[model samples]
Target: MMRRIGLLIFLGLLATLLIFPAVRAEEKKTDGQMPSLTGNIEGGFRLVDVDGSRNKFREHYNLDTGPRLLNLSLNGNYRSSRILDDFRLQANGVGGDPYQNYSLLVNKDRLYTFEASFKKSDYFYNTITYPVSRPDGNQTSFEEAHAFGTSRENTDFKLTIKPENLFKLTLGYSRMEKEGTTFLTALTTAVPPDVTLITTPVDEIDDFYFASAEFSLSIFDFYFEQDYRKSDNKLNFLSDPTANAAVELHESQTVKESLQTLRQPISRAKVHTLLFDKLDLSTNLVYSNSDFDVDINRPKDQFQAVRPPTTGEGSLNKKIWIWDMEASYSLLNSLTVHGIGQISELKQNGNITFTGSSRDTTEDGTVINKIFSHTVGAELEYVPLKDLSLNGGIKRQFRKLDFTRISQFNPPPPIENPVILQSGDTIYTLGFFWKPLTSLDFMGRVLIGEFNNPYTNISSTDTENIKFRVRYRPLRTLAFSATHAERNTENTTTFFKSNFKSDGISIGYQPVAKLDLNVGYTLQEGKSFSFFSSADAACFAFNPDAVNLCGGVNGAFVAEYQARSNILSADALYAITKKIKVGLDVRNIESSGTISFHFSDLGVFLGYLWPYNLETKLKYQWITYDEVVLNANDYVASVVTLSLGLNF
Candidate 1:
């Protein structure tokens, strides 16, 4: 078995050290006669304890709330003059609980290199609620009572070879596996609206293989890469009314199963050359193709009660291509010019078929899309004074898109009108950097742009963006900085218009050599207005003739909203002695708008260093998260962690 072979190899590697005599104290320094092998090994262990709901805390930090091993890590490297110039190994877990990560690497000066790694992570979706609208226009809610989450494992291996100065090759492989609990909601066609929350099990696996080559010469460079990926995803859901009775199942118990597979191949090539010292040129091309197949089986039909093991099958094929070229030239010692042109094309074809005891149907479609863009820019940098430096840049860009779709049936698309979605924008930017004195510095930038959708005259927009920063260091121990940024978009379209602005200031001071302090605050604000159009009315309203409009030609204003956010933070660190230090940090953030939330964290830590490369640290943190509109989701918790490390 592979496991046995791996274990034997690991043990053999560990045994080699016994025959190699211990490094003598006098041989710490490298002498010219022999190759010196030197490396450091450090191991750390941490313990975490939480006082409140473990799931709540775990959702945020991905750590166990109760007693758990935070980390048991080891890393080391050995170097020799032989073929194996360097060999390194790192491990972070005991492979028992929560997660694990491990990696191994080997390198030879210019011949070859190899690496392998494995990692695992967990994800949780704690809150899932279902809301139903009543006849009176009120909404009723039902929340999931069971825990839902998933865990993923990933593995990667790679090898590289470079036998000569002009050529190099690389090969790699990776795999990922995920297992989890998922939730789904369903509706019954009963007179009195009925809802069912279905708990499901999910299993997925993905694998990828890739290879690349590089060629370099005095005047030219070329690189090529290609990769293929495959994935299998499956889900199964079965119902038990007795266990989770948010509702009473009138019909047969629910059962569902679904599976999907995807295959993708991607490739890219790049070539660049230095025509001259002042001008450099590069070109790149990329292509990708993807195929997907899916199958689903359910006990009962979604639209009707009849069930003959309703089944559905679908498949999709997608292909894309991209090409780009760029060039840059140094017109002067302090000025430079650059330009880039790019083109992209995408094509997709898909079909789906459904069969049941009473009904059968099929739908198919194909779409083709393309985009072209060109950009040119130049930058200037000059230092007119010894303490002052000015820098600015201007760029112009043009872009266009074309799209077409053919389908057997009409369905609501992402863009109602493809022509209306095709757009182009022109942007300009300029900025300056000035440092008049050692204690003072300033930087500012301005951007202006215009967007036009030629198919529809009403869908154009004008944009303005500005940002500035200033820093003043009035004293040797204290420094202050402030920043302001704003972006305003004025849309002539019927969709929406918005403005966003942010201002912030920060200060850092070290009154004494051993103590340091930092504090900062930021404010962000935004305003937007949504105006409905005739097309929107035709899509959203049942009776467009019975409504008053914005200007009689277009629909009315749907909403006008303003949002604001404030954030404040402070941190302090003090060194009690050369080997001991203490630090504290506090942060508060609150946002109010169409969506509102508030979050805060306060933490304190203490660290100590001892002889023989030993260190210890203790930290405690308090965190709070709240949704202003939904107080039931509010959570506050405290966590404490202690870690100890030793180096050999």
Candidate 2:
């Protein structure tokens, strides 16, 4: 029903646009003058052909063949009218495409203005691989295969009154919806748990309304806004009985879940001021409160022999507050200083209850959680010369978390003790920009930081990053640019480390007035080390002493992987004649590591401009993708598009 409504609205707008030009033309003929309506409309058709796996092609690029409204733009002005002054309309990708957008704007010459827009997008994901042998001679692979896809839509409308320089009032409303199907894996409740694959369908919607006011004065500006939001979500999981039918003592089950949330009101305020023409200051603040309710239902099945059908209910109340301030001042003729500070806090409280055929429990004990954080930073910029500028800054951040949980038994056991954790980080940064020559420029920046988090092994204790770039344009028709970046991080407690480096360069040439050419290349390398435990080793180890040495029978071991990638691209365009042009583009990407792949794309286009405000274009594209280990996932595709446009 919603999709039908959206289509109706779009068709109505399109009809109005098509008739506007005719009406304006009639008026122009009567007045013996040109009309004020001006713009262009373009429409096209697309064709697609695939030689390999169609699922892989869809997963990589979700484009389909169809008739499409490529683009449209229309603008009209009424100079002698008293109620309507000007209006504009625009649309793109309007027919049977993966993505579409439309917008309209109208103004009444200082009294009021209104705007509306709509957008839709589609997503797809599908990848299947065969089983492989593990290092310990155990087979490891996914037990199920499926394709997942979804679509999302967004709509918005806004209006403003007295939209001038001094003060303006605005009201707006927006909605977002997502619906699709996916896959999930669950474990049965038996002694030796069995894995089961389930198909899941999801639906979600969110809506928001807001009002805002803005005021501007001689040396200061003020702004304030208030908003409200509501959300609804539903999910269904259906078990595949045949997923584990061959395995012994396996059963299938299904589940249903729903959630509803509301945020009554959210408030925001901001202020900006300039003092003495040398000092600038700004501050902003926001606060919001939300409530959520959730329900889950599980049916009785073969796996639930010891238990009956179960139902659960949960509720949560959350609140958050944030504020930030910034200021900058000129200390000398060649120096400036800036400072920034921010603080935020979040709190949540919730409870849960469950009921079944054999048991009924209402654990009303509330679960509470809290988080707080703050940051401060300062920087100074100095320009000692007309061609050189330097800046440096330091920042520090601190955070703390506290939470408590209660047991889910009848009468609710005693509330557990509250747990607290704290973490912090400090960073220093320096940057410089220099333009010593008329045709040459250079820029660079560096950062160093230290972090402390004793509660988690994945946290890094120290980190460093550096980046540099340079550009040279020795002549009017030729130019060159290069960039390099590096990052390193390590955890001292767990002996975990990672590093990344990248470099790129590009050159552009236009030796002739009618031709243009460009080429570029980039290389990237990265590596990381971490620890993991293998279940096969844990089940095979028998000696008690050996088990103790293997991380308490988990057989934990260090794992490492390295990856490198190279990318190359080239393009050219030439004006073959006075009314015709041709262009070509090519790109290739290759990577080698734990998982290797290669991708190539080639495109060509031809454009022609005819007499009497008419234009036509033709384009073709070819793409190929290959994986070194998963040959079944490889695919090749070809696409062609033709378009025509008319201007008035």
**Which of the numbered candidates is closest to the native, going by highest lDDT?**
2
Quick one: best TM-score, which candidate?
2
In candidate 2, how many Å is residue 235 off? 3.1
lDDT score, residue 185, model 1? 54
Error in Å for residue 369 of model 1: 6.6
Clashing pairs in 2: none
Candidate 1 lowest-lDDT run of ten: 18-27
**Candidate 2 global TM-score:** 0.84
Q: Summarize candidate 2's per-residue lDDT along 454-536 as a digit string, tens digits.
A: 33334547899999999999999999999999999876544567999999999999999999999999999999875434444
TM-score of each model, paired residue for residue: 0.73, 0.84
Full-model lDDT for every candidate: 0.67, 0.75
RMSD of candidates 1 onward, in order: 6.9, 5.6
